[model samples]
Target: MIGFLWETFKIKCLGGLREEVAREVRRHLRTNSAIRNVPQPFGYRMLKRFYGKGGLLSFLLRYAGLYAIIMLGCAAIVSLFPNWVPKSGLNSDRLPDVQNVTSYFLAAQAVMIGLLFPVALGVISLITQREDASSTVSDLQVYYSESFAFGVGASGIALSIVLAIHVFWPAGYVLEYLGFSDAGTYFEVVLLIAHLLWLLVNFAALWYFLVTSLSFMRPAQRALMRRRYAALTAIPDYLTVHLLNHRYIVRLAAEIAKKVGWDKAKTALLFGGRLERGEVELNNKALSGQVLSNVWQKPLMWVIRRWLKRCNKVEGAVGSQPDLDFCPDFRRPLSDDGIICRRIGGIPLDKIERFVVGQSFRFKAKKP
Candidate 1:
């Protein structure tokens, strides 16, 4: 009885955990549409679609143009105030004094915070007007845009604090008290450090936004593809079309592979089996000496056999295969003139079915 319970726990309990995780992932994908609809940055799709002609020019106009306008506008504002703009460049023998450095930093921060308002508004507009209504104008989108604005705004404020400490903290007085004669050199070092810090902070903010945006969008894209696949399947007589298309067949094959583990499903199809009865009869000839000539391969074969054993023992262990009602003809025998007999994308449907529905040939695994 103990052995029986332990066996059940390994086959059933662990399998249940795996199923729960997959279901949660699917649930997240189904509900989170913002991830799917967020725009890709850097005009990546545009570049791909229109590579040779004006793609580069178009990208620059759309993205870089706005960036340049913001930056140049800030510079223009600073240039207007000759007193605020630093007269001496970083390479000059006499570095800009603390007052000049502070002035320039304040001017840049003002422009950055000012630019964020319009950018946030644009993000909101983009989210609310997306073609997929399901993904648009949700609380998540509002939060995403608002959070981005807040983060960028906060970063600008933080830059101000850093600059204040690095510039006006009297580092020269402290260096002189420490017996350093070159106060200008020490002040120059402090200014250089402040500039580097400012650049670092801005770069970090940009990187954070890019990474989070991409991460949010990737799962949404996968979910969208799954929805598309589901829609394609809903069309009557689409199975044959899917089987006929190399791309569709490959995609369908991958989905089925995930549903039933590749090795177990492949074995069931190749050797033929009645999984419900916990007996997967193997073709001895298929596992002949020629296939097992390499001694190292024997361990892998043993592992495969063990996995198949556990799979058979587990009740309702088919990974994610849909109900029979959904695909009534999934594993049905091919008619003499049926499309299954025809070669698709260089492989016959009969051969493809072996991996996809081979395990479902005899009995459906009880749905857990």
Candidate 2:
């Protein structure tokens, strides 16, 4: 029973915890995808939602409320360390007061955030936009714009609260309430830690945001996309013409490949399972001819017969023999053989009696 419980904890409980964490991370990423699309800064969005642009007093009140909350939180934490408050006229050896210095530092941060906002917006504006609304490039635009605004706004808010604490009222009077040794020093230490952490996190975020933006302009990835989508440009504007030319789909595809400088082999591979570099998530669905399993054979045969009859390729014959017994590999479509599609594209077929077999044929079918 003990062993069973241990196994359950090891496999089920621990494993579930990891799975839950991963699921939550994915959910957060999806949430960020939406958040990134919101272009406005936090302050603007809040103002817009709660008060009209004309409400100047409401705007001031909003920040005042924010400051009040910050002070309450400070009091809450400070209350835990009862002796945190220093006595009045806590003499200092240095000429420059720490409170004044801290305020100046935080005020500088507020100014810096203000400066950073316009520059970030400008740099983001330089990102070339796609004409298509449903484009990955556009998605990136949304992500950068929203994240930048959020970062700047958050930095501004934090700076404001920190500045206010120093400038207006040093959080609750320094009284030895908790009576812990050097409680006043602990409070000063907390302030220093907060300052260091704020600088560290914000600067790191800024560097990361800028550096990652450079990787977005990948020329090779763009070229691959150009090759992929150049075919869409071939689409005729008229619906009737498009429908008529649908029969020539293969030829049209070939034309696109040729236009994009793909050879016959590369053309065959244009829609094949991912063989090209830089495919992040390649899906492996059946491409080209399907497996003729026992369950599928009868229905497939009927379809083939109907299609052949329509094409006038088969007539009233006594018996029509197809090499159904011969097996073609169906191990996986995204394997190395996937480049050949296991049908055509230079894949050879097994020969049965009176069957003609030669070089591998290229099958045009793609995964359904």
Give candidate 1 misplaced runs (Cα > 4 Å).
1-98, 125-148, 164-169, 178-184, 193-197, 200-368
lDDT, model 1: 0.39
- Give the Cα lDDT of each candidate: 0.39, 0.39
Q: Local error of candidate 2 at 311, Å?
A: 71
lDDT of candidate 2 over 1-368, digit per residue (tens):
44346534533433322223334443554465443353444643443333222233433454456545544555565567555555432232221355676777776667667766676666456554444545656444344443344544565566566566655334323423433223334445455566655565556555544543443456554343233222211121132233323312224335433443434432242222233332222112343344211111222223323432332343532132221111223223234323321222221222321121111211233346
The candidate that wins on TM-score is: 2
Name model 2 segments beyond 4 Å from true.
1-96, 127-137, 140-142, 145-149, 172-182, 218-368
Q: Which ten residues in a row have the lowest lDDT in candidate 2?
A: 353-362
- For 25-99, candidate 1 gives per-residue lDDT tens digits of 445545656544544444333222222123223433433344344334434544465454444333345535655
